[model samples]
Target chain A: MSENLPFLVIAAPLFGALVASLVGWARPRYCYAIAMVSLAAGLTAAIALLVKVSGTVSGYEYRLGGWPPPIGIQHWVDPLSALILVVITAVAFLAVMSARANLQLELPGKERFVYPLMLLMVTGLSGMTLTGDAFNLYVLLEITSLSSYALVAIGRGRAAASCLNYIIMGTIGASFYLLGVGYLYLKTGSLNMIDLRQIMIAGDMHGSQTVITGFILITVGFWIKMGLYPLHGWLPNAYSFAPHAASNLMAPLMTKVSVYVSLRMMLSVFTPDFLAVHALWAQTALLVATIAIIAGSLIAYSQTDVKKLLCYLVVAEVGYMAGGMWLMNRAGITGTIYHIAADAFMTCCLFLGASGLIASTGSRHIRSFRGATRRMPWTFAAFLVGGLSMIGVPPTCGFFSKWFLIQGAIEGGAWHFVAALIFSSLINALIFFRIIELAYFKDVEHEDDVSHPPQVQRNEAPWGIRIPLFITSVVIVLLGVFSPRVINWIERFVDSVGVT
Target chain B: MSDVLTFIISRFNYWIYIVLMMIGLYAMIAKRNYVKKFIGMSIFQTAIILFYVSTGVKSGATIPILEHGHDIGHAAAAINPDHYANPLPHVLMLTAIVVGVATLGVALAVVQKVHDQYETIEEPEILFKLGQE
Candidate 1:
């Protein structure tokens, strides 16, 4: 059981998806229960893996079918990947738990298709996180992307159009990644990441133009996939137009997983030494990330829709994670790994809260939030916690991650990044305050008109919605409160890899 | 001039892959019609498959299967790697082909939905309709 824990993390969801799709056609009611049980099982396996791995500095490896490395497939779970696995499963489980009411409201009678695709997407994400082969990662990335495209298209208005755009961009991004892996395979003759690294080191291929080209291709591919600034054209629309249930899951996990892939390539496959040799490239990447932070925030400030605003902020958060990783020091990478989990929960929290509010009020506009505290105070409170976390307020996970990122930027002498982080945080505060003011204060114009009386009846989302939002908020606080231990765990992985 | 020609001829497959990929990318980015965009997507994926499959080719190498598989214990030491073409890349591309087909199917289905919604598959016209609504 211990040895199969890593595989079980993925298989649970895969099995659930299969069962949901098969059993759903005849009995649609069972799909939700099946999805919940499967995802819960996966979450359990992931937590067990994390607990087991917590005791050791060196993480565990599980080979498929008892075949050894460099030949058969491998699932490598170090402290970092294990932590991310837990984050993925936990966020998915919460999102799905909340998804019942949201999906029924948004995509009625489609639970059968939606549940299976959601499970498959989670399976792909877990596989991408756990797999040790470069090519295997690409296949799993497609599985995740393909299911998400289908899920996004399940929405009503203009959904297929946005999904089409997402498909084109996603294909290009994935193809570029495939081409890069091809280049690496040609140069090193090995697809297994550990084997490829050993071969490159033994052959001293760091200086080879082919290897450099492969590195550039892979980095740019991940950049497109992760929506880093200039290449983020397909993100805001695809996410905002997606069905609320799908967006609740995809909005948090997709880009963050892509960022993790980039970090994995840099840390293990390409090695930090290769990056050090190309300091100019690293600086260029940092500069781009800084611009992304400022641009995402400034654009987010102009949004009228609450969901779209959160989508744009996600763009900025991607910049935070990407920029933190490029800082290349111990603190920077630890912050990045920590932020991935932190940002996942906070984003999930915000999206779930937004969707619940949207459902309760029957509107997606910012004005719908007027006197929201009186209308649905519990959901509003969850959104406020998420908003505060986004603003880097203390005792939430967001603040600790930002602190580490700032320390890393200062140590790395990248003042631009530090400035961008501060600037983005201020913008986040302004945006959230604007919403809060609308929610807390009475609409003055409406008070003057006295025609409508500003209906502020107490209407909250179902317990299905409230419970997940509540748990996610608590997790954010818990992550922040126990960040020292989390960072300490991340540091052990960083130290083992000799990244600094 | 002869040396340059030799260089071009030696890596002709890579050059073709790059050219095909660029053509596909341009269509996917610049074309207005949904069908054309998917056509380009298919071409783009084919180019990648070509790249991977081409990497597996070796001169004077035969298919990887052995005639006496049942007697592999006696023949295991006698196998020469250079005598057999690499099968891994080909196997990987089989998976890639399946993924490509799946992506193409999904893209076309979405395009069908777009057509049904707007009565047009031209991107610009669809956008115009969306704007008016």
Candidate 2:
């Protein structure tokens, strides 16, 4: 059963999508049910895999079709991958649970395709996390990209245009990644990451031009996908134009998973020794990340659309993880790994809350949020919690991760990044607090109006939506207080990859 | 000058890949029309495919299919690995081709939708109309 766990996490969703598509026309509601069940099972598999792999120095590998690595594909289940599996599956399950109502309303008659596309996307992301082969990662990435494209295209108005921009950028990113993989295969004669790493080190190709070119191309490609700083042009429009359900799923996972891929590549494929050999890449990466942190926040602050604001915040958060990891210390890498999980939950909470607000209040701009606190208490509370976390408020998971990152930066003597981290936290505070003022204080100012508006009444989102928001909001604080434990596990995971 | 000429002649295939890829990249970046952009994407994908197929080329090597009646894993009578071309790139490109097709099909659909909604496939014009809204 343990041997089959990796395949189960992926195959269940792929096959679930197939089944959902077949039974979809007859009963579209069944598609949602099927997706939820499959994601639940996948969550179980991921948890079991985590329990099995945690603290184990030697990770498990399940070769495809009984063929060994170097000749066939392999599914590697280290502590890191297992943890990511749990994050992806658990959040996906909740996203699906909350999707039914949104589909019933905004996406009437689209559940036939939406639910199945969501399942296929989950399959792609989890496959990407679990695969040990480099080329296999490309294939999985494309699967995720293609499914996400279809999902994004289903909405009316500008969703199609935004999706075209996304497809154009996404294809270039994937092609660049493929070209990098081709270079690696040429230099090492192997496509499996473990095999390539061994061959690279044994042949002392670490300093070779081919290896350097591969690293640069691959990092650029991933940076594009993660939408860091300058390459972030396509993200906000693409994400904001998506249907609420699709945005809920894609906004949180897509960039975060791409960050995980880059982290995995930096640690496993082009080991830390490469960083030491080339201080240039680390310095350049941190510089780019610092710029991203500042620019993302400033742009987010200027956005009037609530969803667009969240999209820019996602870009800033991507910088946090990327900058944290490149500090070339254990503290920074641990912080990055922890933030991947934390940010996933926090982002989900924020997106779901936005979806609920938009659906009920029938407004997409920040001005519509006036008196929102009175209208939807539960949803506003969740958004507030998520907002505080985004601002790095204590006792939320974001604070701890930022703490680790700052400590790592100080140790590395990268004072610029430390300053950028603090500055961005301040900006995030200003942005969220401004929104709070819009929601909370705006009504009291209008109290003196000669024509007083009718009091905003309670109209909370349906239970299907409310439950997931509450769960993820509670999860942010829970993960925060327990982050020390999370860090310890991540340290061991990093150690198993020999990154200490 | 003779060495430069010889070098270019020997490595011209790579130079071609680079040239085609640059052209595609330029089109992808600079083109205003959506179809041209997608065409650029296809060209970029094709260049990569061409690059991958080039990796499999071995001078004087036969196609990877085995001749009839070859011994099956006998220690003394094994087929030479070099006698056949590297098939891995070709196999991998088959998958890439499929991915390219999927992306192109989806992209065309998106372009169609965008054209229907905005009445133009040129990005600048759509932005102009959107600004009015």
Candidate 3:
């Protein structure tokens, strides 16, 4: 079971997706059960893998069909990869479980197709996280992109157009990534990331024009996919317009997966030594990350729609991760890794809560949230917890990630990043607090009745929606309490790589 | 001057690739029609295939298939036996081609959806209507 864990973790969801797609034709309602069961199994395997790999000197590398590295496709499950796999599968499990009711409401007749496509998207994401071959990453990236396009367009009317823009931008990003791989293959003779790392170190090709070109192309491609600043034009509308369940799942996972890809490439594929030896590459990364952080926060502050605001905040959160990676220290890289999970949970909580709000009142505008707390106290309290996490307040997962980042900045003597992180946190707090105040304090006059209604009402979101939101909120708090242990695990893993 | 010219000619495939890639990129950025932009994207992706294939070409090379009389020891040796072109790039390009086609299919579906909603594929007109909404 342990030997087959890597394949099982990825293959379970993929096999389930295929079965669901085919079997769903006979009984549509069964698709939800199939997807949830598959994801639950995958989640169990991932957690097992994480425990098995924790505090180990070496990582697990499983080659397909018994072929060796550079020839056969391999799945590398280092501590970092194991951690990300857990995050992806865990969030996906919760999202699919919560999505059943929302899918019935939003997708209605199309619920069958939604379940299979959602499962397929999970398969693609897990494949991307688990694979070590560059070309395999591209294939998995496409699978995810194709399913996401379909999922986004599942909404009526304007969602189709937004999905179209997302496809276009996403295609460009993937193409650029392919081109970079092409350049890399031309220069060095391998596509396995570990082999490529060895070749890069053995040869003095760090500052060569070809290697630099490949680096730029790959970085730009990932930047676009991660929705960094100027390339983030497609995110806000796409998230805002997609059906509630789709937004909830995608808003938390997609860009974070892309960020993980970028970090893997920078640290594992291109090694810190390569970046350190190349002045232009390091400076360019630092510059772009700074710009993305500032720009994403400012734009997020200006959004009026709840989902759109969260979408822009995703953009800013990507910047924080990207900035930490560019810092290129143990503290910075560990923060980026921890933030991936922290941000995933925090974003999940917020989106799930927002979905509940949307279910209660079919409106997504921030102004429509006036007096929601009185009507939906549990959901609102969950939202408040999510908002505090987003603001990086103490006793939440978000704060510890920021703490590591600020400490990394200080160690690097880069006060500019420290300032940018502080500014972004301030803006996040202001924006979310404004919504909290509206939901709690504002009065709503009932026009349907002769008298003013009481501050509290009997209305609350359904149990299905509230359960997931509550679970994620509790996870965020637990993650905060256990931050030191998690950070230690990540640091040990980073040190084992022997890079820093 | 002669060395520079030699270098340019040696990398002629990359130069043509660059030219084709630039054309595709310009059209993707400048065109308003969605289908046309998608076509441009396909062209851009295909150009990389050409660039990659070109890079694998040796000055005087045969195909990378194993032959009985070739006396190559293993698959790696067969890759460039008698100065044959590298097969790694070819294998990678195969995957890229499939991804390109998948992207095109999704793009076409999205275009169909856009047509259904706006009743037009023109960017400016769609923007105007969306603004009005």
Best by DockQ: 1
lDDT of 2 by residue, A222-276 (tens): 9999999999888999999999899999998999999999999989989898778
Q: Assess the local accuracy of residue A196 in candidate 2 as a C-alpha lDDT between 0 and 100.
A: 90
In the range B1-133, model 1's lDDT, one tens digit per residue, is: 9999999999999999999999999999899999999999999999999999888889999999998778786768888989998999999999999999999999999999888899999999999999998
The clash tally of candidate 3 reads: 0
The DockQ assigned to candidate 3 is 0.74
List fnat, each candidate.
0.86, 0.91, 0.80
Q: List clashing residue pairs in candidate 3.
A: none
Sort the candidates on TM-score, descending order: 1, 2, 3
lDDT tens readout by residue for model 1, A39-71:
999999999999999877689789989999888
| Weakest ten-residue segment in model 1 chain A by summed lDDT | A442-451
DockQ for candidate 1, C-alpha atoms: 0.91
Question: What TM-score do all the candidates reach, one by one?
Answer: 0.98, 0.98, 0.96
lDDT of 2: 0.90
Interface RMSD of each: 0.5, 0.7, 1.2
Ranking by DockQ: 1, 2, 3
State the TM-score for model 1.
0.98
In model 1, state the lDDT of residue A305.
91
